[model samples]
Target: MDDTSNQEAYDRIARIAQEVFDMPVVLITFMDGHRQWFKSHLGTDRRENTPDQSFCRVPIATGKTTVVENALGDDRFCGLNDVVDGPGLRFYAGAPLMTHDGFAVGTLCLFDIKQRSFAPEQVRMLEDLAALVMIQVKSDRDIGRVDPLTRLPNRIQFLLSLQDMVRADPGRTCWIVLVDVIDNRNANDVIGALGIDFYNEQVRHAATILKRHLPGNTVYHVGGAYLAFMLDGAQDTPHALIEQLDTDLREPLVTSRGIPSALNPCFGIRSAGLMEMSSPDVLRTVLSAAREARLSERLFATYNSDHDDAQKRMYSLLSDLPEALRSQKQLYLVYQPRIDVASRRCIAAEALLRWNHPIWGPVSPAELFPLVDKTGLIHEVTDWVMRNVLRQIAAWKAAGIDLTVSFNISSKNLFEDDLVSRLSEVLDATGVDPKRLEIEVVEDMNLDNSHIAFSRLSAIRDLGITVAIDDFGSGYSNLAYLLSLPATTLKIDRSLVAQALTDHNAAVTVPTVIKLGHDLGYHMVAEGVELPETFEQLRQWGCDEVQGYLFGRPMEPKAFESWLAASNKALLASA
Candidate 1:
């Protein structure tokens, strides 16, 4: 986001806040990039401060207003900057500048040079002023910010409404029901044949059904195919809502040009008695529970505290990952070599991302993938992996290794318009042959927009980059999808690799796939070949490449170089 526009808007807000508080310091502070930076300020020239000294961070981080009437007497503020040093700020009161998604981006704060206390009315006024700042900031993200098509509150408006809902009087109970609408695969196929307008019509009908299940002026088209309603004074228990919506949605809804079709709308319900809560606190919590119920018959889940903690932790991980990548030690790459079975040579290597969190120790990609996918952090992570992997390949060339490298591309990245251009530029800048870089795309995820994916892959292939379908047999195990793309390699999924050696079905299945790949002009690569028997079986099956722990475990860059040297020396000595 360009902060210039937000900053220009913040100037007016900061002036209003400064006038309202009649204090020496009134500032709009944004807590982002792991530090608090002032967006606009009066009575102080300082632009940014460490998190500890960021008075606004207290409110931003907690999503609660903070007041320190006498800063010097408070242990939390006594020794902090602006307390004992320059400006000598002694009083503080801040209201969290919350975004619609419920994240406290910063705080709208006033600090006096002398000790001061806020009356009840003054405090309420301060909160109202802070809310006004939020409204202006949200308006910057959209013009009036409501959906024209749905004629309902969009995600941003929903967020603003959520803040009000959670902050209402304690006796006014409120519930946030997120109805996630998904079309059945075949039903989607039918819709596709009918056209996009048909799908939109179905969603609109499903939304009406969702609105019927909830009460009073609360329905919102918060996200794609999802309707959200803030319910209060519920005459019925929240669980009852899931029953009726699920029952009504089982049959297909009427579309523009097709017969009525099923638009499965799942429900995730969360309620809070008037108490201070943040947007991420409520929305993400309910989402975690909803995901568990997505494939179930009930298709609805109420928020659980236990479930919420994990979601919170995941949020922290996503927030911290960018900083972790920038640090020296936390995020690094490891290479697992893919070997040619016939030649017994290291033919290629796959660059795997490894995050060694100081507390979590080792976080697996399996756990990391979904966390990032949901949080929309996957694209940046994919970019990091690609740039680093390509750079590593170039470095290897300089060191006389000249290794071919393949790195997994996140499913989310396939949709990026610049995906092809970014890869081409990286490869070109690194001076690495495009063929030496293979992009391992998860084939199943590409099914959603095969034409788009295929188009991007074609553009990528035009740059001489090989496209490999990673985990080919795991999802739906659909082999027909391969015929549509220009894939140079098919990674037989680890699960299939586990059984291919011993299981009769897999033994037949594995060789058949290898031949099919060969006939289709793709190199068949078996992933996760941890045993000699498995390696030998795969070699016998004419697997062109085998990548697994049996060859070499993923190692640090320098360690990989050392291991490669040692292995080549051993081969020469044996010869």
Candidate 2:
């Protein structure tokens, strides 16, 4: 009713009122700011009226129906100039069009040429029509404000509520808790196992759970497998309830198919006190925090100052990563030297990624490399790594500090047919010997299309770049597929190497694996050689190469260059 001017609808209602009240005139007019506009009328064709000339204004102001059975006789209504003379309207009975909050915004009234009295039944009918009018107003306004799926107030309505909350208690804080299911990507698995209908049921179940747990909480399905609700006021402590929801939500949901689907719910709580941002901005920041928390391995996390700093860092890195890959700005490679078990000399070093963020200082590969997978920029990152590694090798040869570096490649990169050509272009452009480079792939990497991956790997091998199956045994791999892979080297995972130190079965498994590699004519590299026992056992097992802290840690380019010059086993660096 704030901006509504539906004359046709009001005309229909006025027609009904004319018949219902049996009055000479029936008009439905809404208070429009300081003036009153006639939505419909039976006796008059006029559209608008001034507030003083408005009979509807009295009912709107008083928030109750005005039964002016004798308008000229009533002292309160006699002030109107129209009532005294013009049209000489003496009878009036107006009903207030009230909103949900009890604010009367307009009137539905009846008038007659002569003074008249109405029965109680006619008054009740007038009130009922007014109620219908309010419903129409509210329904029209709520069209876009309500969610279609859950039949709840949507994001827009939530923001409106937030604004109301803020304006009502400017000094108080409001908290928004977001619940997200992380396994929606795997929701397809459930769909395949059961049916797509079950997925819809899961959402209903989640919504029901939220409503049941937090009775008055307004739950919102705010896009992308996320549900949110807000809590206000100081007395309402939500942290304990949030914790309980986190724990209770861990239970697997039984779908309509009677099959249980695991739910990984991550909760992020954001609070604001002493208003710093508008409702929309607050909602955006809160949901952004929820997304970051969902990204973490944690089940639940609250947005805080530290998370703010970390989120800034993460987005900054993500935003800059593409350009960093293309331009190689503030990015470089470090190598961890590997030792030969029999020759007791350096064989090669693993090329590791390092980033020196202009603002955040040195960022570790342990912290940075995962950004590639998350952004789906693994191909770009891999190309950048290889191009730089090859270029660095050529530069090292010129400096008389020759080294053969093994660079890691993501499965996505290995699967791409363009990868082999990309590496060939880098090798040819840099004029670096291809034999001096090795590309390593993790055994755990998804190889559903093994033939295509191996085809590309074999092509790279044919170009003289040896391939190593890295992190062997850390993740399960098919032995038959492993044997068929076009890899010449196998790097036993650090975990397996660590386990060999204590477990007898692991001790026995290590030698058998080494013997199998030897029989297959593949060189075996034992990583995580931290202790004397592990070192001696690996040496006895005839492991071709050993890489761990026992030899040398991953070092900066300059440090490794200097180490290459000083080490007696310079076979890897001065080849």
Q: Score each candidate by Cα lDDT.
A: 0.78, 0.78
User: Which pairs of residues have clashing backbones in candidate 1?
Assistant: 102-279, 252-261, 252-262
- For candidate 1, report its TM-score: 0.63
C-alpha lDDT of residue 453 in model 2: 82
Off by over 4 Å in 1: 1-178, 181-263, 276-280, 324-329, 357-361, 370-379, 410-421, 445-465, 476-484
- How many clashing residue pairs, candidate 1? 3
Tens digit of per-residue lDDT, candidate 2, span 278-331: 536666566666667667766666777676767667777878877776664688
lDDT of 2: 0.78
Alpha-carbon deviation at 408 in model 2, angstroms: 0.7
lDDT of 1 by residue, 1-575 (tens): 23565566778878877787787788877777877887787888888788887677678768998999998888878888678897888899998887777888878889888889899888888888889888877676665557665766777777777666656653666777777777344556755687667666766787777666665566777666677777665656666666777788777555555466777667778776655234445666666666656756467877778877776667677778988877878888999988988877887899989998887788887777766865567777888888899889889888888778998876667788988888878887888888788988776644554788778888988998888988878857676666777778899998889988678988888899999999999989999999999998888888999998897999889999888888888878888
Clashes of 2: 1
